[model samples]
Target: MAEPRHTRLRRRTLVGSAAWAVPVLVTANAVPAVASSMKTDLAVDVVDPPYDLDHWRPKDEVPVYRGPRGHRIAARGSLPPSIRITNVGRLTAVDPSGSVEIIIRDYGNDRASSAPGRLKAGTTNPSVMWTDTTNQSGAKYKYTCRGELRPGQSIDIPLRYFVNPPFLHAEFNVLVAAWVEDQQEGDYDDNSLRIGHVPWISVF
Candidate 1:
């Protein structure tokens, strides 16, 4: 028996539709693979403020009025602390163009304090007072940079903070936390680093 003209036309239409569907399915599956391969993996590591110190003694000790005994005292002065961040990733990490933001937090329970200041990368100044949002858990500061952080590339930031009267106590602790922004992180655990229970002392 010969096939009818309408049946033959329907078969040709189905064949044409199937031919286009094959490429669409294949493309859908291939796009995710290509995107996954291009993803940028970034890791941030804090390279300053040594963690294993038996004790971080004050550079200078000043006696305050006897209000509370055994107050972990920071000299009534300012300390210049150096913070270092490095990109430990296989690909380059680029911050949003124009400015790079770095946030530092004090996770210690005693009291909240942070000094915010802008310093050029690789430069240190003792006069700059690092200030932070009052009573906030963390302080964020932005800087101008090239924004391209290649693997293993590191930048050092200099910061300064005044040793106010209230921060002097025997158990006073100055915990420092640091992180970078604008990178596709592989492990979020390594994106930020914290050093806690640092002895609150003055380094003038």
Candidate 2:
């Protein structure tokens, strides 16, 4: 049976519309999938230990000294440790304005307590103070960058502190960590660096 001219014209129009709608629907459904796959890659790398174990130990064998008030005083040791944090990922990491946080933990012998240290921020010649001592083992540290850590770039923070001589020869563990305060990234396993078994000597 022969269809009317207007009817045939309308049928062709509907067919063309349906053909164009298929790809549009398919693309619309795929958009969520693509967006879900998009993720922020944030990673950190600790470059190296700034000072050796000998740097913490006293150069001479003497460890104790008599104070002015007849009290036993332990020898003083200084640590100027440098910590480097590098972004080893593809995407850039960002934090809120003045919200990036860095933490350092020093696990030393029980006989001696390690004091909080001051930190200088930079990559080569760091001189700006950016850390505050929070406790015996931790500090609230800041990085020099304005809030963005780009891929393959690094920031160095130098720490200076004094430690009392231990009761005997003991080992100290230093751990450094950093992160963005309100970042949405879930994985933080790589944000910390551990340099264990740093030796401290106390000679009686």
Candidate 3:
């Protein structure tokens, strides 16, 4: 079932396509609907993971990457997972074109860079945050691509994910973050997104 908007809490009032966030929340969502306010100028999002880009990419229903054959992502975590990208800004996200940098975070590390600034817990729904993958811990990897992806445009990341392991069950927190250089995102929020995983497992 979808969650009620009233139950959803954001650091700031989201304008543009961010106004409607999916029910995907962590324990932190129970806080007040408004806080001091967090903001980001960064213009792209990982619309949804787990649903796999090739199979289902949501836009009108909700919102929810790339690569050659323009941009691609390495599947990591408890994943064979793929992420979708969307340009949610009024202006185009580009270095004169579309330049996107992505970092795949490990299951539970919630650092503000490359990882979610806020800790979220759930499955399938994508969470977005603002981060720089400068110093990340655990099994994480980074990917980037340069092209022209206009505002409101989306691209699905190709499936090429891998996970390093010791042992585990089927469930996992599949986390990822994206950003563009030269543009400063307003808050340490929403340039990154994460979701829990279903059965399919790949271990090293």
Q: Tell me the tens digit of each residue's lDDT in model 2 across 19-107.
A: 11111112336586754444334333443433335555322221223221223544332222454545544345564212123222334
State each candidate's clash count.
Answer: 9, 0, 21
Q: Top TM-score: which candidate number?
A: 1
**TM-score, structure 3 vs. true:** 0.37
Superposed model 1: Cα runs more than 4 Å off: 1-36, 48-81, 96-138, 142-144, 163-171, 196-204
Model 3's lDDT to the true fold?
0.33
**Predicted candidate 1 versus true structure: per-residue lDDT over 54-78, tens digit per residue:** 5543332223221222244334311
How well does each candidate superpose onto the true structure, as a TM-score? 0.42, 0.40, 0.37
Query: What is candidate 2's local distance difference test score?
Result: 0.36
Candidate 3 residue-wise lDDT, 51-137, digit = tens: 334644211121111111112322223322344555544344442212223333232332222332212111222222212233234
Better of 1 and 2 by lDDT: 2
Model 2 regions more than 4 Å off: 1-39, 50-80, 94-129, 136-138, 161-184, 196-204
